[model samples]
Structures are given as structure tokens and as C-alpha cells.
Target: MNDQNLLERYIHEVGAHLPRRSRPDVQLELRSLLLDELAARGLEADNPADAAGVAELLKEYGHPEELAARYHTEQFLISPLAFPAFRLSYGIAAAVVTVVFLVGLGLRLNQGGLDLTELAGFLGSYIETMLLNFGVVAFVFYLLEGLGWIKPAKTGAGWDPHKLPAVKDPDRINRTELLVGIFFTIAALLVFNFVPHWIGIVSWHDDGIGVVPILSDQFLTYVPWLSALWVSEVALKALVYRAGRWTRRLRLAEFALSLASIYVLYTIVQNAVIAKLAIVDGIAKFALWILLGIALLESGWQLYRLLSGKANHPLGVPSIRENQ
Candidate 1:
């Protein structure tokens, strides 16, 4: 093929990926740039009939998708500004679905001996549910953004450099920890509220399979409060992520949630009775006690910070009172 034909094919491929409204102009601009680059390289565009020359020039230009992607300015359902939050939300949703599927699978296995066919079916359903949840979360965020209900801050738009948060302590707000907390909290809420039966054990014997409930019926009574606490914790962690720094208000919120969590754990530990499994009961009680102790320590630490005015300013932001 002639150099002209090859160049035309390249341009056509790029144009194919571009939006109709901008394709023509983009193609023209691309062609002009290519010609300029070839001329700068001491290559004659008209004689690009030389396969080697055409190859070299085209290589410099990049692939069609790469070139087209650079020219596309349109944002999809989620804008770049809101993408981080959307991603976190999607991850949480996926985690919830996975937890529910796994727990439900265990319950099913206990109730009716493990069957490969049933396991495969559950896997298929789990994937479908995750996809549906992702789509719903994306759509909701799109709607919220469109309605101006959640306006993500844009670059150089009323941003003050001096007000940037401080990060004196590298471990002050661990993003990974917060994200993990968000995922597990959401998963726990889903498992307890929607698929409570999954919180049990499955045993297989010579005769048949047996299922035993780990949580007592009274445990259901505390789920509402537990769910609410989990929801609040998720919301607070999300806010911390968005803010990228901790302030007095956020610290107080964290402390309150931590205290509430300890109380919830205490109640659950006291009332969660296990049937037919003393080991399971012991394990559950021990885990709850450990969690309660951790919560108390966290609450105490946050209270100390707030009282000492350490939480008054963000990492980079200096306290106004200190300046005065």
C-alpha cells in the first residue's frame, strides 16, 4: 500500500473512535500535526510511499485509541471529581454482595448438604447481583451530581492553599484502615439484616447434613441499632476520606461512634447465645470483648486529642488560636 493509503487508514481508525461532533475537526488537526512532525523529521509526506518512512511516522503518532482518547473531553456518568467517592461506594457495594453470597452459601450448605450445582448457581447469582448493584450505585451518583445535590469541588475553584490540612502525624488518618472498616461494616449490616440465617454452622455426618444457629433469636432485636451504628461509622469514614484531614468535629464524631460501638458490642456479647456449639459461643464472646476493648481505647484517644485541642486543625492547617 502507498504511504497516502496507510496514513488515511490510520486517520480513519482514529476518527472511528471519536465522537461524531468532533471527529472531523480532530482528524484535520491530527493530519496537520502528523504532517508537521514528518516535516520536522526531514521526511517527505508526499513520498510516504516508502514503507519504512510511513512506519516510523505512524509509530510516532501512537495508536488510534490512544490518540482518540486524548481528544475526547466528555465525562461519563461519573465525573473525575466524584470518581473517588463513586469508586469507594462501588467497592463497598461489591463487598456487601460478596459477604452475603458467602454467608448464604454456608447456610445453604448446612441446610442441604453441599452440592456443586447449587454452588455454581449461587456464584452466578452473586455476580449478577454485584453488577446490578454497581450499576445502581453509578446511576444514583450520576443523578445526585446532575441534581447538584453533591457538588464535588473543582480545581482552582475557591480553593485556598493556606487552608490545606496538616499531616504532622502520618498515622493520624489511615485511609486503608478506614476503607476496610467501611467494607466490613457494610457487609456485617447486610448479613445481619437481610440474611440472618447465614450466621451459623454447617456440619456433615454419615447420615445427613445439619445446620445450627449461632446467634440466639434475641440477637435479632439488636440488629437495628447495630445496623444504624454501622451506617453512621461508614458515613463518618466517607466524610473523613473526602475531607482528607481530621478536624475537631470529625474527631468528636469518631469518638461518639466508637463509644456507641462499644456499647453495642457489650449488649451483643451479653445476649448472643449459641445453641449446640460451646466453642462457637466462646469464640464469639472473646471476639466481642476484644472489639469492645479496642473501641474503648480508640474513644479514649480521640477524647484526649479533642480536649488537648490537637483535633482543632487539619494536618497542614494551623490553629487560629495558636497564631493569635
Candidate 2:
């Protein structure tokens, strides 16, 4: 290729990856730089370009992706200011998607019995859901950043160094645990309400396919209360995230939720037959009993901690005296 053609090709490749707003200026600057570099190397642009020389010059300039990367001053979707929020949102989304997909797969296998066609359809739908959600989250954050709605915590006129609190024990309000709770609660609510069909089993016989629901029809009756409980937990977690510390009120709220959840579990487990799998009916009942036992133990633990004051440090904000 001639020198002009080679340079234009290189410029086009680089420009392809650049943002449309800055592409024209970037291309012009890149072209000028390439021409200047060639002149410095004593390669005449006027002559038919040697393939070897063009290759060497492009190599020195770096790969198109690397060159384009240097020009990216702004983040593609999420700015640094909104990164923590974006991470939390994406994490919750990912967790919900995974749980829904797994639940759907399990139900399909248990109810209809598995076929390759069904499995492929489920996988394709899962991938599409994940990609769509990821794009939506990223675009929302990008729009927020573009509109100057989410500024860095330390920036802007309202921020004050003097108002910053002293560092307390890092154990207070475990962010990771809170995030996990929020994710699972949201996932459970989604599966229970919007996608109840995903909680069943599929079986295959010589003649046809059969579907058996894992949850009893009565399970639907508890969904509204269960959903409310989950929504409250999410709200509490959001408050903790905003405050960056756990308060006494939050601890009390959590304790109340735990108690309510234990009660709900008790009522649900009393039915003895939540799932109707022919082979695993006994095992499923055993699992529900085990879950009830765990909830009881958790409630006892919470009560003991509340009374003994052990839960104060982990779930309560440190006092000013404690910080000293």
C-alpha cells in the first residue's frame, strides 16, 4: 500500500474505537503525528510506501486499541464518582439473574424433565437477560455522570472535612454481608412473585412430559408478606450504605426482621409437604425442617447478642468515647 493509504488505514482503525464527539480532532492529530514521525525517520510520504517501513511505523505507534485507550479521559459508562454505587447495583443485578436462572433450570428439570432443546433455550434467555441488564445499568450510570448528578463524595460545595466523623471499629455494619443479604432477598422476592413457575420439577415418561410444582399452591399466600419483609430489608441496607455506619435503630430493625422471618418459616414448615417430588419428598421435608432449625438458632443467637450487648459493636455505631 502507498504511504497515504497505509496512514489512512491506521487512522481509520484508531478512530473506530474513539468516541464520536472527539473522533474528528483525534484523527487529525493522529494523522499529523504519524506524518511527522515518518519525516523524522527519513521516510518520504510522497514516495510509494514500503510495506516494511509502514509496518515498522505502525508498530512504533502501538496497536489501535492501545492508541485509542490513551485518548479516553472520561470513563466509558461509569465515572469514578459513581463507581461504588454502580458496583453495588451491578452486583445485586448479577446475583438476581443467577438465582432466577438457577431456579428456572431446576424447576424445568424437576417438572418437565430435561431436554436439550429446553436447556438451550434457558441458556440463551439467561445470556440475553444478563447482557441487557448490564447495558441498562451502565447506561443509567453514564447518564447520571453526564448530567452531573453524582459528584464525588469529597467534592462539591456541601462537603466539609470538619463534619467527617472519627474512624471507628471497621467491624460495624459489614458492607459485604449487607450487600449479600440485599441481593438474596431481592432474588427470592423476584422468584416468588414474578417467576413462580420456576419453582417446580419436570419429568419425562415414554408417552409424554409431566410437570410437578415444587412449592404447594398455598405458598403463594405468603408471598405478599414475604415480599414486604424483603423490601424492608433492602431499605435498611440502603440506609446503612448511605450512613456508612450501623446505628442502634438499624440493629433493632434487623432483630425484628429476623424474628418475623423465623415466624414465617415456622408457619411454612408446618405444612410438612411444600414440594411434591416423588423420590425426594422425604428429603425436601427434611431440608425444610433443617432450615427451620437454623432459623431458630439464628433467632436465639440474635436475642442473646441483643441482651448481652455483644451485637452492639458489630451492628451498632461506635460512640465518640469509644473512638477515643
Candidate 3:
């Protein structure tokens, strides 16, 4: 990643931990400060670094949680000196709400089977009560602190930067995209293999709803191989989602999948009869060719990225160095 990308990621992580109303302002200021810091140290923001390369600076700056806390405490409703007590009080009250909710649920279950409507109402109330409890407790503390009636006994003197976490990468895959891919992939696998006829147009008859089989017998021959590839693709996507970043191995795996996809698409367009109907076959072949082109482009880019290591940081959490 470039110095600028790293700077943005660090700021983004900090902003994610910040309250919604303060996020944009905090991120903007944080970005400016980080850029200034990098420039002061003679670092070039436009140039690509072998790593985030600013791990040391980030560590010394503060952990995401601590930095967010520092800003959060300074908000209008809360001050740093009163924050510890406010947090403790809120925690205790929240626990009481949970206990009350659980007790009510137990009583209802013991009396009779809880219907869905009653269960939903109970859940709604539980959520509302918890939020109400939090607001009440926080407001009381806020007032007490404002009136100088409550304060922390001592200020924190030994916060550790070593306990900090990490940030994002430009190459970071979208988890929602992966989840959607998995869903479509699995659905296709089921439809193609177990219910091939479902792919065609649906018709409503006097007897019942009917579906005409659109896939040719040749598709049956390729089902096992295609299903295997689809399954592999889903598995890899799931792994990337779990890791929250792409690693070298995952990139290679995806590249390999792209190659396999290109092969399957090429073969289908050239040799396989995807649809028994003439017009459908023509349309399917055209679509397959388009997919093949996309696969080739994606594979080439993946190989280039692997070789160049242009973005030095692989996906997942970009690790920051601990204070020495």
C-alpha cells in the first residue's frame, strides 16, 4: 500500500470505533494529523511503502480503542473525569435489565407455550427496556458529573499501546459480496444438479405449476465437475470472508479458480450443448464466451498482483508494531 492508503486505513479504524455523530469529523482531523506526522518524518504519502511502514508511528499515537475513548469522553454528554463512573453505572444497570428480561421469559415459559406474537412483543420490550435503562443511567451520571457530584478517584497512568489492533487494505474483499457469491453459487449447485428442470420458464396449468427443462443432457455429464469447481469457489470465498483479508495463498487459489472457470466456459461454448433448444443454445454460448473473457482478465490481474506485490500489505488486519 502507499503511505496515503495506510494513513487512511489507520484513520478509518479509529473512526469505526467512534460514535456515529462524531465519525466524519474525527476521521477528517485524524487523516490530516497522520499526513502531517508522516510528512514531518520525511515520509512520502504518494509513494508505495513495502508495508504500512507507519506501524511505529501508529503505536506511539495510541490504540484505536484508547484514542476513540479519549475523543468519546470529551463529547458534550460525557467528560473524561466522570466517564469511568458513568460506564460502571451503565454496565450495572444494563445487567439488571437483562436479568429482569430473563426472569420474565422464564415465567412466561413456565406458565404456557409462548406464541410467536407474544415472543416478539417480549423481545421488543426487552430491547426497549435495555435502551431506556441505558439512557436513564447515562443521563443521571451526566447530570451528576456536570454538577460536580461524581468523579473518578484516579486518572489512568499506565495505558498500554501494545494491546492495540489493526486496519484495512485496498485489496480487502467485501464480505457482503462474498456472502452473496456463496449464496448464488450454492443455489446454482442445487438447481443444476438436483432440479435441472427448474432453470426453464415456469408455466401455470390447470393441473399445477410446471417447469420445462432447459438444460441439455450434456449438462448432466459436466454437472459433477462444475459442482466441484463451484463448491471450491464458495469455500475459498468463505475463507477470505473469515480471515477478513486476502492472503497470497487465497489469491493464488482464486487465480486458479479463474483459470478453471475459463476452461469450463471455453469448453461449454465450443463443445458442450448447454440447452436443447436452438435459440437458448445460442444465447447460452454467447454468455459463456463473455464469462470466459472476464475470467481471463481477472486471472491476468491476479497473477500480476501476486508477482508485483504492489500493495505490500496482504488482506486481513494490517499488523502494527508494538512499542519497544
Residue-level lDDT tens digits of model 3 in 74-123: 44576544555567788788767766666566455534438999989998
Q: After superposition, how far is residue 108 of candidate 2 from its true place, in Å?
A: 31
The TM-score obtained by model 1 is 0.42
Best by lDDT: 3
Quantify how close model 3 is to the true structure by its C-alpha RMSD in Å.
17.2
lDDT of 2: 0.66
lDDT of each: 0.67, 0.66, 0.69
lDDT of 2 at 198: 72
Q: What residue pairs clash in candidate 1, if any at all?
A: 165-316, 166-314, 166-315, 166-316, 166-317, 167-315
The segments of candidate 2 whose C-alpha lies over 4 angstroms from its true place after superposition are 1-171, 202-212, 314-324
lDDT of 1 by residue, 79-188 (tens): 54455578889989876776666556544533433568876887789889988998899999999989888753322233322232222442257889889989998999
TM per candidate comes to 0.42, 0.40, 0.48
Give the alpha carbon lDDT tens digit for every residue of 55-124 in model 2: 5677667665556767889855664345557878998997788666665554554454467887788889
In model 2, the clashing pairs are: 110-201, 110-202, 111-201, 111-202, 111-203, 112-202, 112-203, 113-202, 113-203
Runs in model 3 lying further than 4 Å from the true structure: 1-168, 311-324
